[model samples]
Target: MRVGVLTGGGDCPGLNAVIRAVTKSLIGQGQCEVMGIEDGFQGLMEASPRVRELTWDQVSGILHRGGTILGTSNSANPLRDDATKALVSRNAKALGLDVLVVIGGDGTMSLAHGLADVGLHCVGVPKTIDNDIAHCERSFGFDTAVATVTDALHRIESTANSHHRVMIVETMGRHAGWIALEAGLAGGADIIVLPEIDYDIAAIALRCRERELRQRYTIICIGEGAKESGASLTVRERVEGSPDPVRLGGVAHVLRERLQPHLKSEVRATVLGHLQRGGDPTPFDRVLATRFGHRAAQLVLAREWGRMVTLQHGEIGSVALGDVANAQRTVPLDHELITTALDIGISLGR
Candidate 1:
């Protein structure tokens, strides 16, 4: 059977590894053809859709690389409506593919489900920086981002300590704070703030002062989506005809502004921005991506439709797509581990 594949939404480390694995495995069978779609659903919607042929050599030497050859766009999802769905359906048939493999986080996987509802045969592989894909212990690129953020925090630590100031470092995470939690803990951040818990800034400022009393410098790691309990800090900007509106960032600036007057202490903010996503894959991510890619190919060969490749309890496995899209996986603010951090007098900004 011939298979078609696409990587959608944000680009992550190990995407190339998955492509290489799929190509190598399919080629080994001697009876399968694997094709790639470009730029997510938008590529599939073009009038005369084009595809990249997967030859073994094309995928070689990319096992440890970051990003994908197929490219990605968070704004693209082709199965949203009749017109776009028809386009994708026509393109898939035109390419003569038997099944489709989609690698992405929630939005991309949800697009696969939508296409399936209209008679498209597909499977998914979860990919997200948030590490919030349900039933999956972890996803590819997460380790890499964690390492990146941790390193950044480490670099910022000495400066904050030397100056005896509060340093707020912002990392990526929309509705979950796994990145902030892991990186902050690893970087020895005095305070770690996440969206999972409603924040009390005044209490956090007090803790910062206490840290100052003891250590004289405070380093706080906060997720971009982190918000205080009373009001959201996002500033809505007008977009034309978007089905869902965009929620933009400013949390770091807002948090700094709020803390400045309360503490009367020197406060600074450093936004990591896209630096987290713009580097080489960490060793962990490289190995994990290779494994996920190789296993994804095996799953395709076995015809496990509607299952997403996932890492659970240190094992490579699969989970039903429905479970993946149901809701986000989040870290409990008062979890045993969280309490442990609290016991050590870490400020969670709550």
Candidate 2:
């Protein structure tokens, strides 16, 4: 079989592990030819992509690496234009690829589903630090992102205590609050804010006052998408033609500004931005990515096209690509984590 693989959307820590696993697994079969597709679906639109043959030697030693060898792009969507879609089809046929493995989050998975409709054998491997992909309990990079944020919070907590200040740590979570929630819980944050729940600024201010009375510094973990009751804060205007136009940010600063007047302590906000997306994958992510990649190769070998590998209830499984296309798996309001946070008196800004 002639197999092609690509990674798309925002680069994450465990991407290289997936690429390595796919390449090594397919090559181990000895009857398959693997081609690395460059820059996501954009590579498919190229008249001649920078496709390269994959071998054991080339994929070795990449398990600990961050980012992807095949590259990625967020704005490359074949469905936006008929000509581009045709070009993708032509390129795939020209390369004689029997199967294509797409490793990405929601946007990229949606693209893979579209490609499958056009008769290209496509399989998806879920990849997201946000852990927001539908049908998957947890994405590979979520653990690493949470760990990174937790470590950052620990450092911030020390400084907050020393200066008797209110430190607001911003984490990445556009539509979901898994990162902020998990890291906040694990990092021992006094307050946790999420996009899923609108925050009561006045209530948060009151909490800070109470903490100040106890002579304890406050540490708040806020998701980038966290919002006020009826207001939204953004760091910048959305690009007109960008795929991800809702660039949520500045919520931490907004919170800091609003809460400063109500608190006696110094208030500051720190945005972790892309730091959560960088660095080496955690051990859990490495193993999960490897499992997802190996499962993808096995699916292709079995000709089970239009499926995406997922992890649920401590088991690796597969789901139809159509089931998760353009779907988001958000943190449920009744989740145990939320209950735990509330039980411990952490303000969710609700």
Candidate 3:
């Protein structure tokens, strides 16, 4: 069997671990030929076969590495574009792949489903910093993203306190607050903001001032899509057909400006951005990615194509690709846990 693999969407920690695990596991089966498809679906959009060889030595020393060995992309959806479809079909036939493994988030999985719908064999492994994958209990990069934010919050807290400033740390969670919520609570954020809650600039500023008066400093954790009441944070700033819609400046900047007046002194915003997705993945992510990789490969071996490896009830597992097609798992607006922010005197900007 000839297997082709690629990473898509934004880079994340544990990506290389997945690649390493998948390559090593598949290579052990002497009959299998493994190919690295560079730059997500774009690889298939480019090369005659859109695939290249993966020797054992090339996979070495990348277990603890970040990013991907085969590279990644934010473009190429055959189902969405005629050009992409032509490019992909041309490459797939030339490559002669029995199966293709796609590792990434919702957009990437959606692409995988498209290929499968077109009669291509494909398997998916969920990867998202947001941890918002539908039906999957967790995704590979979520743990690492949370830990990275927590660490940043820890460090930012001290600086904010010493300088008597309000530190607003913006994290990536386009439609969910998992990253902000978990990391905020873990790192003593006085207030945690989420896209699920409509925020009030005045309320957030007041919270910071209140914390400033009481503790001499304030730490605010805000999700990228978090908004002021009746207002949006990031607007679409890129091409419509693109999976990763370029975002305008995020809420952290606006909130930081609003918060400055309330602060007794200095105020700043730290956008975690790609830093949260880089470097050595936390142990949890490495383990999870390895588990997902192992399961994904097993699924391919079993001809369980079109099923995405999902995390269920704390276990690595699989789900039908169609189950997640066009679906988004967002933070529930009425979650009691979210309501608890009010109980603790942390405003949700309501």
Candidate 4:
């Protein structure tokens, strides 16, 4: 059997771990050849696709690596162009691929579903740092991203205390606020703002002022998608032809400006943009990626097409690609973490 592999969407930690596991598992079986697809689906559109035979030696010592060896792209959707879609199918046949193992977030999984509709066998492995894939308890890179954000928050807290200022740390989360919620609770942030709930500027400002009165600096954690009650603060305009064009950002800057009038201390915003996406994979992420990869390999051997590997209840499992594609799992309002944060007097800007 000849199997093709590619990574897509925003690059994340532990991607190399999944690739390593897939290549090593297939090679160990002694019955399959693994091909690496470069730059997501764009490789398939090339007249001479950019591909290289993957071997055990090539995958060794890559478990701790951050990015994907095969590379990735967020904007290459074959479905957008009929010629490109045909090229992808022809290229897969030219390479004699029996199946394609796609490791990516929601966007890539949706594309895999589309490819499968056109007679290409696809197996998906979830790989988002946001932990927002529907029906899955966790994804590979979420742990590493949370750890990075928590560490950054700790550092920001120290500086805010020393300077006697209100520091707002912005994190990435397009539709979900898992990163901000978990990191804020773990880092002991005084105010936590999430996209799931609209924030009240006056409440956040009052919290900052109260903390100032107690001779304490304030630390605020805000998700990039966080919005005011009636408006959204965006840093960039939507791209005309992009799939996800509504870029949610600049909320921290908006907060800093609005809260300044209510607080006597200095207010500043710090955007931790791509820092959460890069860096070495945490131990948990490495193990989880390996498990997901191995499960995908098993699915291939079992001829289970159009399925996505998922983590549920601390165990690796599989679900239908149709079920997961285009579905986002956002943070729930009545979650235990939210209650815990509220109990600890952490303002959620409500």
Residue-by-residue lDDT tens digits, candidate 4, 101-206: 9999988889899997557899999999999998899998999999999999999988999999999999998879999999999888999999999999888888
Better of 3 and 4 by lDDT: 4
User: Which sections of candidate 3 miss by over 4 Å?
Assistant: 47-50, 246-249, 333-345
lDDT of 3 by residue, 1-350 (tens): 88988998888898888887788778875457889998888787764545678867788788788788777877656567776676677678777888998998988888788886556789998888888888887888888889999999999988988888888899987888888988887777888988888787778777777776688888889999887777756763676667766664367888888778765667899888888888888888999999888888888888899989998888778998888767778878777667776677666665
The residue ranges of model 2 lying beyond 4 angstroms of the native Cα positions read 233-237
After superposition, the stretches of candidate 4 with alpha carbons farther than 4 Å from their true spots are 233-237
Clashes of each: 0, 0, 1, 0
Rank list by TM-score: 4, 2, 1, 3
**Deviation of model 2 at 93, angstroms:** 0.8
Off by over 4 Å in 1: 233-245, 334-336
Candidate 4 to truth, TM: 0.97
Superior by TM-score: candidate 3 or candidate 4 = 4
User: What does the lDDT come to for candidate 3?
Assistant: 0.82
Cα lDDT computed for each candidate against the true fold: 0.80, 0.90, 0.82, 0.89
The local lDDT score (0 to 100) that residue 143 gets in candidate 2 is: 97
